[model samples]
Target: MPADAARTDEEWTSLGRSVLLRQLALGARSRHQLDRKLAEREVPPSVASALLDRFVEVQLIDDAEFARMWVRTRIAAKSLSRSSLRRELAEKGIAVELVEDALEQVSDEDEIEQARDVVRRKLRMSADLADRTVREKEMRRLVGVLARKGYNPGSAYSIVKEVIAGAAADAAEGAEPEG
Candidate 1:
């Protein structure tokens, strides 16, 4: 919302509607996010409440659906972990129950794969290193990466080990001469 724009609307309902639509045009927003934005814009609570109820009435605002979509997008685009996704959705003002439910969308296998994917991309650069200590150090760093992305230590260690072994196998295969 522009700083100079006056939110003091004699017709409060229309003002809320206009502001909401403008925000929505920019991107999909959660109901909580919209409420905050309206408050920041100085819209009256009564008007904001009325407008929000109407939006939800028309399916223009759905927190449950928003949580689901948000989880899916972040997982696909950023490979976030279930715990990380849950925490993020909660921060976004989605209900804790809905956040947990949305986090369920990422299966355990998907979580493992996401961890593997993170470590796999980093493993290639460390693949041919000669120092065992240096290679293990690099693997630890990769594991830390997964840990920050919300994998438990065990899962992170397992992923790091798997990717390292797979990279080694690929290197060995590539080095062998044709029979």
Candidate 2:
């Protein structure tokens, strides 16, 4: 028989604990993520449950805290909209209530500003803003960027329009000759 098949429940539990600790050492993980890892390692269901339960009892596994931190970090790093972040958290097995609670941290105004900031950065890097055709293309691309980042269509279009208009006005002013 293989070594795994010969292992007792205690040995399996020990393996499960070590797995959890190693994973935790790397970063915070949702309970479901940990459960999947244990299952992947072929740890027995009972042993895995007991170990996971113990970890929860000791406060080592708090999905709420995990969800909050994940939301904060993702927003700061990627400026993702709540819808996109919600989808991501769901994929990680975060509970609906926790996901909603975490999403609450980002207000509508905050999301708008983030989108604006992203559009501004992209606009600055665009070299052909002086040409109408290139400006239109850049506007389309900026709207697409916001769409891919999960911003609603209406908001994305409006933000891009506002930013591009402001940039155009500034450029026109800069091009005028001194009186």
Candidate 3:
């Protein structure tokens, strides 16, 4: 007979708790993620539900907090736009409302600034921006980079234009003959 064949509900609950605690120790997880982990371990449905409920009751599991921290960290580290962050949270099974609450922490100015910074970094690594053809190609490539990072097309185009123009002006100022 299988080892679990003779286990009682209490035994299954204990196993579930052990698995949950271990997973939590690694990092915060959404309720959905924990549920999937329990399911993968083949813990009985009722026992898994009970254990998860208890964890929630004691605040060991909080999707809201997880979403908030995730948003803050991803934005700071990746310079991701709100759309990209939304897609990431949704993939993690966070509820729409919780995702919105977390996204509220990122203001419009914050998004624009992050986008500008991304464009500036890309512009710095490219070929000369003084050549008309090179500047146009760089503009398209930079805008595409921001687009992939989840900026709106119009906004991405505008930011790329603004950053490239600033870089070109800086380069021109440096090239001017000394008095």
Best candidate (score: TM-score): 2
TM-score of each: 0.87, 0.93, 0.92
Candidate 3 lDDT over 1-179, as tens digits, reads 99986899989998999999999999999988999999999999999999989999999999999999999899888888999999999988899999999999999998999999998877754478888999999999888899888999999999899988889888889889999
How do all the candidates rank in terms of TM-score, highest first?
2, 3, 1
Give the lDDT of residue 62 in candidate 3.
94
Enumerate clash totals for all models, in the order shown. Answer: 0, 0, 0
Put the candidates in lDDT order, highest first: 2, 3, 1
lDDT of 2 by residue, 29-101 (tens): 9999999999999999899999999999999999999999999999999999999999999999999999999
Question: What's model 1's TM-score?
Answer: 0.87
**How accurate locally is residue 101 in candidate 3, as Cα lDDT from 0 to 100?**
99
What's the distance in Å from true for residue 21, model 3? 1.2
Per-prediction CA RMSD (Å): 3.4, 1.5, 1.6
Error of 2 at 53 (Å): 1.4
Off by over 4 Å in 1: 1-10, 177-179
Q: Candidate 2: global Cα-lDDT?
A: 0.92
TM-score of 3: 0.92
Candidate 1 per-residue C-alpha lDDT over 67-105 given as tens digits, one digit per residue, 9 for 90 to 100? 999998998888889888888888789999888888888
Cα error of candidate 2 at position 88, Å: 0.7
- For lDDT, the strongest prediction is 2
